[model samples]
Target: MTRGTVILKNGKVFIALGYSNSDSYPSGEIGQMLVKALSNSSDEETVQIIRELIGGLQKDEFSKDCMESLREIGEAFYNKKAATKVGLDDVYGYYYDYSYVYDIKTRKLQIFHFGQLEYSFKKEDFPFLRLVVENDELLYTLSYDTKNKCFKGIDAEVKKVKRMKKAGKSPQYILEIAKSLSERIHYVVDEVYSSDCWPNAVQKGVTFYPSRKRLKFIFKENYGKWNVYIQLPWVRQGLIHNCTSRKAAMNKLIAYLDGNWESFQSGMDLYELYEDCQQKLMNFYNACDQISITKDEFNESVGQIEKEFRGKLIPLEELDYSGWTKAFGPDRAKKEIANWIFMTHRHIFDCIQKA
Candidate 1:
């Protein structure tokens, strides 16, 4: 049996790519076509052909092993300087094991974002996917490792439940899935403490925060992976830090309770405060560009400000420029409402001043 070479981007598995013959393949023609497909990352068409060759064989021992590697090597055509050689370098060629690619991606991803957990389909019909969850995070790629043969990273452990179906384009649905998964992992240790988990009053004594500020763990999705962090009322911004695993997340939550966590910023109700500030800022900004300032100006200015900041004392009644009463002067209207709003915000609470 004569041969041709199918060089792969990865060279971890340097074994012989079987010679062409009539039994498994018609000739070396099939081999060259595979190389082309892999080079282009031709998803559907190439994947379909490779499927027939692999059939039901274990990945490492398949007849179409080298060609199957197109799943990974095909990511970007095989360039010697930037590729890994898979299978043996006979005339028949090399292929990707996807498992090797998964490992390589895992190592490379750690260099950039340790929280990234990337995964993808290695073959068109292959039920198992590749997964890569980077360090200290209950990280695994069902799409990197065999979520069944799941890997343990620095601070996290991973397992694959059934693939999420509702994790579609819906933000609310995805958030729900993330919350469920995160809390399920949390309940394993700290009564649903981490994993995008919400802080609950545990018997009024066990609290995630020393203050009444609600500390919610956030698994903010970054691309396909998640940027796992916390959302605390005291935090001025999100993405406080990466929580690599379920256990690590709980440990950090403990830090907050123990009054030891060093956050980027600290103040109560920061997100809501930011929302209020943004609304007011935009209202002021829009007013500045207006050519004329009359009823429209009042509508935009007084209307928006009142809408956003409703006073605890009294509602912002509509302006009555036409029927101005002598006793209820304009100065008091501005003082009791607008000035009060400003003063209430300006007055620094002791907790904030101390913090």
Candidate 2:
């Protein structure tokens, strides 16, 4: 895969180009289709098809025709000299066992960003939240390997869960939590942490900060196969530097590092104060763990669970949410339903804006 990443200030925009490893694909197909998509009457449809053709598979395993088409499409995005000379290639293709592609098909394509990375976001008000977007029942298998020193693999076989009904469109349900934070403009912080597993986070996507200030997001994928991430260090650091005290800075810093309220809020005082700023920063980020059991962590964690825990878990449908009515009594359930309705209406404006 020929991949490139260009981080621009303020997240105004960026672009990326990459190839699917599907051997069935040819080199220039991605480039060629990108050009065709830009010119097509239905830009969204064309782009969707192109994205699926290249991104919807694992590495080097694509149809030869697909790869060639993508390469040609990628070349069309830039001058022959520029596209040909861009020294982007996938080195961990043999190691990570997966691939990614990011493309910015607009303007002169001043910035193209691409990497196998992942990150998450939430409103400052909601902290104890988890978002479950898309029900991709991924399964994982275990194989012994001395090279995987970072994580202990649970010996298992590769297989899919049987007797399971596939879910339709993925759900984007994530919990939300909030905390008070403050920050000044123009500062950057770099932090290093360990992965939650041997393989680090291997996901990729882009974010836009539309605000009228310069910003930088930098990170290196040194963690593990597909498990690396980038963050707005300056933004995060600036917030830390301006807090009420060293302790406050430490708390907020730890919060960001943990990314989950459940993990961050455990076994600690919410209002504890730190006496030293440097110490606080060091202490907070030093403990951050990079590994996560997110569904995407594997192409098939669900299969592993089903195969390993055959009769331990019940069918999802059996746990009827409305069953709560019987347990708590119908009147209470009705009251709860009324509260839900009220909350829904109150948040209608927010939903429309997001939509």
The best candidate in terms of TM-score: 1
lDDT of 2 by residue, 1-355 (tens): 4332111111223232233333321123433343444344554664465455444434453344334533454432322333335552332112112222323342111212122222111121111111111111111111112122111222111110110112111122111100000011111122222233223222212211112222222222242212122222111112223344433433454344333322222211111111122233333223322333332332243234323322322232233233111223223323433453345433533333344
How far out, in Å, is residue 265 in model 2?
A: 4.4
Writing each residue's lDDT as its tens digit, candidate 1 over 27-87 gives: 2344333333333344555444444433322334443654565444543322222333543
Instruction: State the weakest 10-residue window (summed lDDT) of model 1.
Output: 106-115
Q: Which stretches of candidate 1 lie above 4 Å from their native place?
A: 1-44, 47-125, 130-157, 160-180, 185-253, 257-270, 273-277, 294-300, 311-355
What residue runs in model 2 are displaced by over 4 Å at the alpha carbon?
1-45, 48-165, 169-267, 270-272, 275-355
Pick the lDDT winner.
Answer: 1
